[model samples]
Target: MMIKPLLLAGALSIGLLSGCATDANRVPEITYEAAANSPFVATNYRAADALISQFRASPDGGPLIVATVVNIDALDQSSTLGRLISEQVSARFSQRGWAMVEMKFRSAVYMKRGEGELILTREIGEVARLNKAQAVILGSYGVSGTVVFINMKIVQPGSNIVVAAYDYVLPYNNEIRSMLVRSTR
Candidate 1:
């Protein structure tokens, strides 16, 4: 009787161990660093896709200008995060065959030291006019709790009407925190 019980317990232990191994193989481990780095590109791509889905204007309507994304609290200020987001989003649009005007080459948009090209609400028309931009891509970001919320819009330059818009959020991790820090110089 004792030998039989020992054999049954041994069998159960082996089964449990094998089950754990199978589960381990099925679920790949994802580290924090990997997760953080992956979202930046993927999220921007999704943002572009979301905007494109809502866009009703013709691709040949006119060139699209992407401005540096600013902070919601301060429309004139932008951080590395804002600039990077603008670049990535613009790349996505360009990759999808949208004609995006490179604002850095154009002197019409206002630029601050350390900050990228900034197009204020009032100056949108003038900047767009100078670039002959059919639409302008503008965005702002705000931090709340452990998440950073971003809102993007494609506005018709002359009418100041939003042709497409998208709202998304990202985890407020160390990588994002570093990007949000503005340089004092």
Candidate 2:
């Protein structure tokens, strides 16, 4: 009888201790918040817009297609960036009545993977005729240091000409503000 009661008491204590350790309510969780002060985001867009303006002033008039249709991240994000930039720039361009090739055109850009230089030029030529584009704008967002370098290149689609380029620095990348302002491209 003594052994039976002792065993029962021991089991109860073990069960209670384990129960407290494994309680669902005690699980930890994490949340992310944007920074209070940062200028990377604002600066980045400014740089991109400046590049666009320069292309408009030039006189190449090639395919007039601005797209990020290259296979970027290891997990193909072609459509996301392609549509995002194209549409965003396209909309901004539209506000001023500037002609731009609609992104609906299904042209693929392949540059041996991550080789944006070759692929960028390829896609410019592939886009169908709408309004001849004088330049093509492209951006890349992977950096090795604290400074994130986003590149925007304006190219002549038909002749594969690089009329203008913009490489903006985003050193102030925080959750609240991003430093992606327009700089010399």
Candidate 3:
């Protein structure tokens, strides 16, 4: 009868739906070794240390201004990862006894709504001069095939010369992917 066919179809649909739901919940389990090797912040700290080692200028030269890291393709745009990396690198510099000028307290640098303080190559001199910064720390990042490459430079504003530079790579994991989401604000 028509009713018997309808009942069989309804049962089959429900069974298929439940099977898909179960499969959707099964995420691959990560190993303990993998979990212990998380390296986003630590990698950045190491890069900062490398830059510090190569730096010939004295820590007492003057205060250093740290700018937020931005996408290499779009210098004005930044994501959560960019801001966090800037903060971590600034902290490392401060811990190393370098006087770091806090960008949030100064309005001389260009700050976008969703992006943090960003000084273009042309505007670096003006911003550094306005803040009386000895050097400005700038960085850009690019992603390629499960890895994110970062390059940081400490530049003397007056001479527009790189005092120190460091380049590093980080694994592009889920956490990084989330942080790379462009701000809607």
Candidate 4:
């Protein structure tokens, strides 16, 4: 009697597990649709274009060193959002016939010096000088509720004067957030 019960239990266990392993039962079928504005790339691009136009209209505008985007609120310290903004803005500037100095080398110098954050305007000017750039393009972003406000500034390194500034407000949706921040494995 004991042997029979044990064998029956073993058979049931195997049957249940085998049933669970089948793809049809394990996962539910779902359809996915392609998004019209994937990752909101166009939004960033528009902001970049606007920034370029604003800067070019200024008297102090010309060759600019694009700096990494700085978050004055300290929320995006570990996020890649700043880098994405910098790249997009720089690309737009380039497309509009403005000379752009890449930010990576200048940023690396500060990283080597152990600067915690890149919010200092004076340091930004120094970086511009190092790259032989006439002006520096620096940006800052802040989030309030479900909205994000981004501000881009063009400043002359010599006079420490802001030549132009552009502001953009965007909804803080998941797609946009993912583009700004990197996902860790």
Error of 2 at 98 (Å): 1.8
Model 2, CA-based lDDT: 0.50
TM-score on alpha carbons, each prediction: 0.78, 0.49, 0.80, 0.66
Note the residue pairs that clash in candidate 1: none
Q: Model 2 compared with the native: what TM-score?
A: 0.49
lDDT of all predictions: 0.88, 0.50, 0.88, 0.66
- Best by the TM-score measure: 3
Better of 1 and 4 by TM-score: 1
* Clash-forming residue pairs, model 3: none
TM-score of model 1 (CA atoms): 0.78
State how far residue 107 of model 3 sits from its true place (Å).
Answer: 1.6
**Which stretches of candidate 4 lie above 4 Å from their native place?**
1-36, 56-62, 75-78, 106-108, 112-119, 179-185
Which window of ten consecutive residues has the lowest lDDT sum in model 3? Answer: 176-185
Stronger candidate by lDDT (1 vs 2): 1
How many pairs of residues collide in each model?
Answer: 0, 22, 0, 1
Residue 4 in model 3: shift from native, Å?
Answer: 17
lDDT of 2 by residue, 1-185 (tens): 79999999999999999998888667354334433232433454565567666664633333355555332342233433333444555555555455665544433434333222234444556543334455566555543447544566766667776766776554524421222222111
Cα RMSD (Å) between model 1 and the true structure? 8.8
